[model samples]
Target: MLNLNRNSHVPWISAFLLIISYSIANGVYLTIERVTYYPIFKSDFTSILLTIIAASFMTFYNYKRYVYLIPLSLLSFLLTSITPLILLLPIAYELRKISSIVGISLLITSSSMLSWVFLRLIANVNTYFSLPLMLITAGVPVLIPIVWFIGIFFLFMPNKKGNKDSISLNPLIPFILTLLVSLLPYLPYINPYKFPETVDFKYYYSWLLHPQFDGWFFYTRPFYLILLYLLSLIFKPYPVAFYEFVFLSVFYVYSGYKLASALDRSIASLAALLASVSPMLITFLYSGLEANLFSISLMFLSMYYLIKKEKITLAIILSLLSMLSHIYAWAQISTAIILYYVFRFMVSKIKPSKYEVIYLSSSLPFIFTGLLLIFMGIFPVPMSLANYNDLIYQIAVGSWGSSNMLLFFIITMLGNRFMKNLLGFIYAISVLGTLVIQPATNLIIDLPLFIPAAYALRYIRKDIAILLIINLVLWGIYMSINSVPKIH
Candidate 1:
């Protein structure tokens, strides 16, 4: 059995430290406006050294449990937040424990160092920015909570549990079909060239070279990238990509089924399958942000299990795992929980904690800053906001966002979807659209409004899945459009 007493608070403590370090190293304060450039502590290598010392202390002190490594990895994220930080200390510490640790560390360190160095040395070396990229990097984290709150408020509407349901046996076929169709973008095409060195595959290669790759780009952290790489290896060729997509879709379906089952037992697996393979799920799977999909599904599943079993520890574990997938996942999952209680509190006329709002809003700056750093590399790409605005305009009109708007409108009129739900969806669509407004105005005035608006929208749509889908479609259009020109 796990030693709960010995490491009861370790997880939360680690989570807190991870949040703090992440905020400091990659907060939104750095990204949107470029208020600063140089790191408070320059060489990232030393950060690694310090992180190692810190993790080592925790490991030695908490010998019975591996939870020490949790905070340690969180700290490591801080160390490698800016530049390529040598990870000898982390590597050594991991080696002493798990065998897979060394390989994972190597993959992580090498991918990051090589990517950054390649960006600096090979791709476009000699370019330098006047100030730090803090403002832009900070925007994403800041924006996450804003949007999450909006979703929570929306989801907090009137709904009671239904009757129980039975699970179906043959639900996998449609799930697989829906997933395969969603992955049409990543397939290889026939090349006219003998070596296939050159072809009219403009759409295929353009996104790979988008100049604004970092602005709202997915796969920023090396861990995420490595996950993609390993998933690629395990599943490989192009069809394997379908596996991750299908599996996550399956999880989402199961979660939805379990949820409906709680209310009405006769619920057909079709209900779950439909929810799982919706346009939203397909969109997220294609965008390369698996964590959002995973977390949302887990959060719902956690809620279902929590209600069924009423076990706090299990719920906490599920919640923490969701957080581990992506910090934003924590915000959405936690906000949903709070909103659920808030609704009940309102109904019961119970006093609520004032600090809840404050705590949830705190992580915004950090997520934004992290995103900014990933995009445009060391900050300040050659392209201006005006250039990006035009790009967004072109892509928006021709592709995903507009397409979603049409679909949404159609569903609203024909499907009998609730206006509140429509509002929630629109709010989500707008927050993502906020990315295009980057070059048009200064963030000081705009960010304040945008942040709250995101929250407001989230309040209107507690379903993270809905928000994630809108965002994914936005990302796909951006990538597909941006990548198109490069293939030539």
Candidate 2:
């Protein structure tokens, strides 16, 4: 129950005050806690403060574009800081604020902050440093959600504008060549069968427990994994880890082509290629997060269907499948549905029907699952619900070695050009989050995929490709520094 209605600036100012107050309060508490008891955590206030500033800048930049969300975002951020016991109580309050930028911003910002703080507190670390503090504090809770907010906004932002897209496919061969070269790294690394000592390798290797079970059992849809495994047979019978990367890259490329075709062919092709080579996709080359690969592809495919055929039911089904594939897929699913509804409402000149609303509600079950897992901690498997900090250890090398990641994060967070492109912003933030939470290689692979998919933004934003390449190069540097043998 934070109030912003008195005036537009009131909530924003209030939020700023709240954050400053909380930071000081939290810092003082930490100092006292340490002095009283051999404090379990040493606060890295330098890193924490830096992360907050960076994250605040990123969030502020994005929220400024849709200024209405600031109050809600600020409110949500404060609420999340309160104990988790009141999580449900705040739901109704947030619901009343939903349509405005304030509500959506609050939702996104609060979720990010809550997730960040939870990871920090639950990890039971002896010291709090800038890296983890910024990561969970600003990066996860605020920046990522801000990106999500922009994406959702773009999808539904009432295209009150029109355009004539005539960027013909110039030099298709060159485009394909660039895409192939960019993606060449994903081709199976010459076999060393043993999992490389990177962060997410073990999480994926867990699947080796049922290597013969077919990843299809992992989810209801088998087409994605099945198709990838079969294609790998044509090459060498590599581990599904390699195949997941290959298939996701190809599918991401094709999906971008399909989505971009709605705008321009060359742009779509470039976007597709960028997606194929992005850090996110590259990381998947080794992480074996097949579900992420599969579901994202399906989400884009569903968008293609919705735009082209107006196949609402089919689109809904695909979206649901995408949601089921992974918790992360929720952002994509929500963005797509929101865009579809907004488009139909505007173009068809009709209010949303009951069915339209119901169809959109399909995403709720997944949301519920996430909430249950996050708040109640009623997870199905203890391993699946392993504290998010585990991702730090599992994906350590790819993320950064303390200083490296923090530095890279500072440079990227402050300088990432894609921040202007809402989708690119989200992708950029996501890559950082993934680096912190998952294995380094997995993040490396997955970054490219998410970048291109983000282009589904209705506006033909060229910055998407530019920013993606920047992230890609940064990731390459990270890998080169690691001196992990390049299996090429």
Candidate 3:
């Protein structure tokens, strides 16, 4: 058993770190075992138990005592090297000894060195999504868990006195930094000048030039392509699609900044800067998920404006456009809104505001018109809805490919619990709804991950946040460059 004081921030950080350690390990374990069928929630619960025991052993710093966990740890071998932050474990531990600017500079220096080593030895061959060192690789094997798990705690345990956010009064400093840092990781990925040969891109390109997508009804979504078509009259479809990725990438960070600024102006830019280089946006950009990007960005903006409460009209319009843009976004937004509203009502006994009622009411006519169009054969119904009987008989499986977002999701979900305000509830709902709709798959969960990362930054001093984001960016660069396309 572990010594859990049940006081202060340990419980919350523990919950978050538990997810971080377990998910990385468990995801890898399943991959190594190559199991076809496993209980999702049950296995996750087991990991939680195992992780608690592991963390207890490390917190006590007893090597002889931790020897017992080795057998169990070896059984879960795949989680050895998680994020680059794990690689920084020994260095972060040393931060306890040297807490000066020069010491932190040395930390940054060491981070770069490790990143280069990884790129040369591990990332060059592209063996796995995480660090390549396995459990039995070399040296003291138990030391792997000790250093990595303890480092997870050390990353958050910043010195209390210097913990205030040190964001510049001028927002441009952070904005320019975010842009520059954001640009670095994306440089290698700029290889595809235009859309390459892929199954979906072909139809998307044709739809931009043609008036009717006659056979693509079941699989095609027209509104986003229609927007591209109008844009293409002036520019080429490829360029239009290309720039949309760029616009949404920046906008994703901006939305987080706006939402974060509303809560804590001090760390808003820090949050935005961190969000800028996260893996989700880059992964989607390279995979060419333009509609998903557009709709999700709008949905986040809608969430942001709704929280502002003064821009209700803009919120409604963006919400409507989110539905128009993609079915997946609609599923995500609608599910999240309903749950969020219910939580607010249950907690405060408050009903939806006037603008909220109006927003829901306005969507009705558009919804009816679309259904009526489908009924009249003007537009075909989705294949899933049309072929419900066949779908109902088949097994439903959930998949997640962007291994880059794994750590981001872990941090976001747990950090959200510390938030008791609007940003907390909405994005927490966003995280939950994402899992409900598509698992923690980074499908609808990408933009939502940024807020909590930024939100978590509010507690840390400026210097520490910079250190964290730098380490994260270095990790993200390795992941993005070595990544594969999410969709075929």
lDDT per residue for candidate 3 within 1-488, as digits (tens), equals 55534223332333334444544443332111111122222344455455655444444443353334334444344444232123224323323321344334435443653556365344444333233221111111223223222323433443344344454535565456445433432343432332231224554666665657445432235677677788888898766543455455677677767767666676677667666656555456345566777777777777667666667788778877776776455544555566566687998898988776676566556555554665565654332212322211121111212232333443454345445655444454543332233233343344455656665555555565555555565554443343323222
Candidate 1: worst-modelled 10 consecutive residues by lDDT = 441-450
Arrange candidates, best TM-score first.
3, 2, 1
| Model 1 residue 255 CA deviation in Å | 2.9
Error of 3 at 1 (Å): 23
lDDT of each: 0.36, 0.40, 0.48
Best by lDDT: 3
Candidate 2, residues 1-488, lDDT tens digits: the string is: 22233334333333333343333323321111102111123234432343344234333434433244334334434443321112222222322211333334333433443453334335523233322223322222222223332443343333233222422334353235334433433323411333342334444445443344443344433444445446545654346443344445566667656755544454565455444434344344433456666777777676566545566788788877676665455453454355546665687776666655665676556655654653453423222232334543333322332212222232223223332333343344444444233232333333333333433322323333233333433333222222133333
Q: In candidate 2, residue 127 scores what lDDT?
A: 36
RMSD of each: 24.7, 14.3, 10.1
Predict model 2's lDDT versus the native: 0.40
Q: Ranking under lDDT, best-scoring first?
A: 3, 2, 1
TM-score, one value per model: 0.36, 0.43, 0.61
lDDT of 1 by residue, 1-488 (tens): 33334433333333223323333444322110101222332334544444444444445446555445535455564445522122222323332222332233324433443343334333533122201121112212322323233443544454333211222336564355444444333334211121111121221123323323233333322233345455555655243333454466667766766654543334334344445334344334324345566666666566565545455566556655555455444443454445544565687775535433333234334435534653546433233433443432322221222112222221222121112332233334333433444422111111112112222222232332233333323322222212211223
